[model samples]
Target: MRHVLAAATLAVSATACVSTATPDTEPKGVVVDPISWGPCTDIVRPDGEPPARQEPGVRCGKLTVPLDYDNPDLGTIDLALIKIAATDQSRRLGSLVFNFGGPGGSGVDTLAQAAKMFDTLRTRYDLVSFDPRGVDRSSGVRCGSNADMDAYVELNTLPPTQKTREAGRAANQRFAELCKRDASRLLPYIGTGNTARDMDRLRAALGDAKLNYLGMSYGTQLGAVYATKYPNKVGRVVLDAPLDPSVTFRQRTLAQTRGFQQAYESFLKDCVKEGCELGDTVKAADANVMRLMYKLVDKPLRVGNRRLTQGLASTGLAAALYSEGAWPFLETALAQADKGRGDALIYLADSYTGRSKDGTYTTQMSSFPAITCVDSAERPDEGELTRTWKEAIKISPLFGSEGAGGICTSWPVAGNNEARKVNAKGSAPILVVGGKGDPATPYQWAPSLTRQLGNATLLTYEGQGHGSYSSGNKCIQSMVNSFLLKGKVPNQDVACAAA
Candidate 1:
């Protein structure tokens, strides 16, 4: 899940120095004081359940970490944490830390809402989540006001023409300028490598012997980097709907385009079965959808006070592709769009971009591109992306280019995490789960991640949507539960039916 080509998204760690590590790889001088935990304050979930922060016994604290790991004495920034303490303390298995996907998403809310799902584990393990640096509650990246983001996201991203791409780049550059004005200090240090270092500090602060981790989507990439960096400190690991650590930014975009195409097929099948007004065949419906997008590109549709542009329409479609349950919403949006109404899709797009009904926003929009641009180094320029425009359309005329026309390459800072494989050698087995029809991280990425990791097991769910675990796939949920609970990995890859 990306939105308006800006969602190429955005943490941390275990460990001692590996013999092969360079000077930069070893976090020798870095020191963090132990966190003093206290009663948790209520934190509104940026993109999840908002009420969990008020739950009893929930604890919140701030861990001070080096602003730049390479320069530990420079200064420190606080990484926020939320904890649900273990109930069966006598039989506890230490803490299970989490990194929810958004590179920009807050982990505090993710773990808080998920406390009930692991009822048994909750008694045996302390559930913990942290807002990685540059995310919510942490050193968040603040660009311009919500009005600025509203304007930026509305910039057209379709057709990939030189003129339109430049316009998009110019608009993105303006947003980047706003970020540099407000958040330039955190920009350079917001890479995933730095985030991994922060995680190690968190692990040490918690007084845990080893890290028990559960990461999803972009979080999986963070977990892999952490495992590789701190091989000896790893415990059981679960990477669900993972990103291929070695793929370049362009490769990731094309893959996701195809992924969304596949997911759209699923949505189309379900919609046609349910007798929607879209069409009778995939070709007819898809063409109509493409025509709608092109129409929006030529002229945005005004629905109430907001104008629904191609980017918003595409983002709305991409957002619903994230979960099968949201597919019906897409159908309704499409049918309404057919009747010259864009309210449903506008609402959906607003949801994806973290916009409120009152037109405000969380930090997800700015931080998404900021953290993403810093993590990977291969964001293409206008020329490179334009060259691939035809092939991108061939892969997905609707979303093939969502990964293209991005303004990351035009940012103020450079990326730190280079394109490479993450081999967490000399570590415990890492479980990699893939949703067969996951549009965001894609299904094929799991196999790539599974192979890249030194010790990894691939768990496949033959299903539609972005993630599998705890999304109603009992086999996946059970398999992951067993792995996290008993340190077990499947003898071979386990495949499950759609949930």
Candidate 2:
């Protein structure tokens, strides 16, 4: 998930190498280091429970990896890793690494949270998760003060006109300047390719012969880069909510705009069917909601003592659009907003900003954008951005083009040398999953990415939301669990209904 604040709306949404010598020599594209293993320290494990107690059958460990792979001597970073050691040790499958969506999301947190659902796979192999570079408890990258982040969220997303485009450009320039001043050293090294390389290093350090992995949202892109660069070293891999490697930054954002629009429409249709509070007719309710958004853009509403601005309202709306599970709350919020009550919208905005009622942000919004600005290429300039925004808005009026292109354009860095299409020809069979109604990474991206990888099978979850695995879909969980556990790939397309 790419959560960068542009005008208050947090829009959520790699590789190569060479050289070979002999059998005992380092592989052609592999970066080898002297094997070093030591007792894991960095983290102070919780006290009440055993420091490293296994969750069901999974064992946990903390691994120290170099903050910068190119300059391992610089410093070391700690990654919290959890593992479900293979049950069938005699016919043991290798470790399967899992990553949740956020570029700044913690895989360890995902593992800890989803351990129970994943126990089935523990019977076959270790299920592992580690925080990627620039994330929680992993030597993360921090930027300007909370005020700066607040200003960032207020940055505009709509650049439909030349004037708006210029505004966005200025915002981008200012943001870039701030990031450069605050985090120059760490900014340049956070792209997907580097993260992929980090994964490889982790795999080697953990003593895995090959990388067995499961990635979702941004994780899909990371896995794609790894497969392309180290195809031969890849074991069973699963990529959910796959991103289209060919699309430009602006194009990708625009696509997400359309996705949110579709998702909102789906929500409206569903609400109408259920005769929800938002409205009696789905179309009527949608129109009212759009009107409310436009109104907020002009004049923000007040929720008790808090002032809810248009930008923040939009951000909340975008965040709510993320999952079907959020639709009900979104509808209620929209209804309240329609009635001139802004508290619901304010609460939603608070959730989007990762802010608590006591006025504290939950590391998510702060860390999310810091990682995003570094991972992808530069945002487009004023003229180009304006043109793109106009086109995108026309494509999806509900999410207005300017709204979609807002965040990244203001990112601090220029494009790094990240490979667009990964060549994963020799990689083991990889499973690619897509949600039919994913407002972030659309389902269409699955087939495209599958085709890009020489050995990939597309798995379709005819459902809604960002990820499919272990999220209540028995079929997807079973398929993914089985694949990670025993290298089993479904012979044909696997489909699951929206729950």
Model 1: lDDT to the true structure: 0.76
Off by over 4 Å in 1: 1-31, 39-42, 45-53, 298-304, 379-382, 418-421
Local accuracy by lDDT, each model = 0.76, 0.66
Local accuracy of candidate 2 as per-residue lDDT tens digits, 81-180 = 6665666778666677877766676566456545555567766667777767766566656556666766766654442455655665576567666766
Candidate 1 displacement at residue 18 in angstroms = 13
**The candidate that achieves the highest TM-score relative to the unseen native structure:** 1
Q: What is the lDDT of residue 346 in candidate 2?
A: 71
